[model samples]
Target chain A: MKHSIHMHSLFEKLNLEDIQVEDNSTLYGQANIERIRKLTLDKVRKDRKEMSFSFKRQLCKVALVACAVLCIGGATVFAAANEGVRETISSLLGISQEKILKVGESIKNKDYKLTVLELACDSYTGIATISVEALSPKAQETFFKDNIVHKLRISPVGYGLREEAPDEYRRYFSFSFKVSKELNLYPEEGLTFSMEGISKKITIPITQTVELTELDIDIPASEGYPMSYQKLYYSDLGFTLLGSLENEDVNSENCLITIEFMDGSISKFYHYYRALEQVKSDNRISVAKTQASIGRSERSVKNDTAPSDEDTIIDFDTEWFSGGSNSINSGKVISIFSFSKEMDWSTVKSIMVNGTTVRLH
Target chain B: MEDYIIIKRLKQNKEKALEYLIERYSSYVVSIAARIGGRLLSIQDVEEIASDVFYAIWKNRGNLIETGSLKPYIAQIARNMTKTRLCHKREEEPLDEDMLVFSSEGVDELIIHKEQLQFLRDTISLLNYPDKDILLSYYFWNYKLTEIAERFDLPLSTIKSKLYRGRSELVKRFEEGGYYYEA
Candidate 1:
């Protein structure tokens, strides 16, 4: 409480009103304004084009899913017809064909037919591919336009769905769920994928469990923030980096994670998803606070232990595909990076964070 | 143009909205950058900062719709961008001994308590108009005494005297409020 106060610090903290001054007409000429306008407008156009391209790519991916669903007509010819789905799942998850559990479980009502095509999981994450075919024409007409998909919920509360494609008769989607105490899908469990009116609890067939590889890391301090790599869990599904930053004001953007593959390819974990923008628009800081409090209460209830003084979960995932907790509270930070395509961990030559590299043989 | 209309057009990615923004706020941004950087920054640097501020507004158009008014947001961006430019310049080239304001006092480090800072803010709010403006311009905005004098159309000696009186009043208030500044 008793400390010497720097004069500059005092000046920096003062929040004063904007100084009212006469117009300095000679400052910026018409040419300067025109130049800035051109540059900014060009950037705006470029961003719009990029966003359009991204949306089209998403639609194409959805089409692929719809095609996979059409190929597998019924549950009777499940193994033979679901080859495309199996291959797609295999490629998306970076797993082998054998690891995918083909559950062509179909249930129908008067309005729709929902089929669970395939599923893949580890101890920390699970992926399920599903198809919802509109049996009624009315349902088909409103399928792509409405919030019908949001009504469909999975038991493990934190599951997120991505629409692969929507055709005249059906829509294909993939659901990714993170493992929690309430829902542990690994080594088999009864998982329920339900809609508002129709629901089903299907037995998640036992499959291979992807072992997590821990990387030996030592990240040196940089930019006044002293950081120490606590743990690194790597798998084809994704990688999670648990570390601590001594400075409480460390921004999540500064904690850069880069993976260098043996094929001279580099993957940087910094891409922000459109959903994240939506989150920010909806006041994400308050949402983050709510999630943090919920996480604390859940941890305490599950283990019958008190919550840590400053434990919080911060989602830093680009796609929000998985529950990647990029938590930073009282200097403890955890960053999770989920891969969209096949990443051969064995092919990873090194992982660098904030200019510090840790080689993996 | 109204802020809402400009924000709507900006969200729609209309180039005219950006043109309007640049036409309206370029001078204001320039004034802020000039005042903050003073003699340390060149005219080119100030111009670049103004351009960057507009570019930032374009990049963050999605979040602008929620901001009821655009001027405050633009002012904040201009201030931050100007400070960042100055910080980078300082790192690249060290300040001269004559330019160091507090280095000669032999008081190396000071930690201002949060409570005291709040009290200082409250006291500063209570100060008279031109005196408060002069103090803020000199200390907070980093405006040179000559620049402050020219901006307010007062002599350099008058600007210096006003700053001295402002500092004395702040110190007296701090002591009366039971907050002591050692050395």
Candidate 2:
């Protein structure tokens, strides 16, 4: 009664030529294809038009907001100048324009000038926007053309630039660094931003930190994976789950977090490793072993363990849109769940993890 | 119609190219989706999945390689979509028994490794004519036993026996290769 999960995985990896089959066109008539074609073409056209319209509308909105901020004639004027930075901070951090900390810090060389425009940080995550402007035309031609900005590094947590930027602010780039308390990577003092070929470095201090509501509650272990909860820190942006697992085979990916709001709304976050490709390529044997161990653990749980009548096991039907980062060090696992949209943490009634619920209120 | 020509037309944003693609691969997509979905999904569900697969193809036309055959890409999409649909359906209802096949007697014996998967692939390739074809049709394409029987013009019992024998051969090969051990 062994599961065919591995078999399915094996089959998927097979060469296309090996599994080639004759076209059974009789199963689906010509009428079916025609209908599919029409529907697909209509969708493509609609998507294209909508994308165009959306881009134009967003540009207009951002432009208006930028102009409005400039007209106000205050600290916001700096943010208005770097609209790309301001927009990214607003979107990613789920914060208002006023809450965005304006860091008018700059470090320059003969070739280029790098300016730190804005930054937002909490207990776990930090996002900063930096503008790399070429000082000379030659620098612009050689450096910008080659896209050498990726050579820039922010120590401890790596930085990723925002791919899509308005044409007007093509030089503006946003770098985000996330630090987890459980991992002991929290930059209590500041972050060091440096670039290759440049001797000078800029130290952007963590001046302002967003207030996070902390909840300390002990949740009983689920039948499948034996885990103990320690703390839950949540804000308007997202939430973090700090727990310890007795079984190392119980991957954080299987730990589904569902937040039930006071208003009867629910938000689910599925924990997935961001470096999954790296794990598969670099540690294939380890991954296979982990999978096998997980299978064994699941089998034992099913055969030996029994849940009490009060215990309810929730099976999530919907595909989770929000992503969570999981890191396990010495049996202690930290799962940071990021929300797709801004949430009112006060309105949350209870948080459930793998069917075990802990009331917050 | 050739896959390259169809890919070229798709890249050019020609709607008729999509029609050609749908006409050529609709049956193939439907077959994959139907086989994967099995009794869990209705005819309409399978049809919807087929449409979605085509739509995905059209959407990713720019990324499609003009030289390579589109069958693999289409097959992958069909499998993915059908599996995703099944997962969502499983959330709404009780777990599908076929999907949640547990190991007997709580023994943690069978472990599939990357090397073993490669060995399985090699073994599958070396299989004799109709056996190889039947195995691919049954496992890779996820064709039903009855469907394989009909396609091969063989009896259902013969098809089943062939599949069982093929699997046993795979196990034996794996054991000899030191990739698998019987419990």
Please report the candidate that would top lDDT against the real structure. 2
Cand. 2 Cα-lDDT: 0.53
lDDT of 2 by residue, B1-183 (tens): 799988866664445578888888888887776544444455666677888888888777757898768888888898888766644211122112212122323244344445456666777767765776677666655666666687677998987778777666666666575433333
Model 1: per-residue lDDT, tens digit, A1-361? 4444444457676543433322232343323655655665666556544533333333333323332332221100000001111124664444666766788887777777877888776544556788888788888777777555555544432222345436567777665544422212222454656565675545554443565666545564454233555566666665655566665443333333445668786655332212223333552221110001001111111211111232332223221123233334445554444444434657867665555556665
Chain A TM per candidate, in order of listing: 0.54, 0.57
* The best candidate in terms of DockQ: 2
lDDT by residue for model 1 (B12-122), tens: 444457788888888778877765554445567777788889989877765776556788888889988987775421112211211211112223333334555665676
Q: Would you list the clashing residue pairs of candidate 2?
A: A317-B91
Q: Write the per-residue lDDT of candidate 2 for residues A122-193, one digit (tens) a residue.
A: 666455777776777777666545544445545434222343343432366654445665666555656666
lDDT of each: 0.52, 0.53
Q: Each candidate's DockQ score against the native complex?
A: 0.07, 0.12
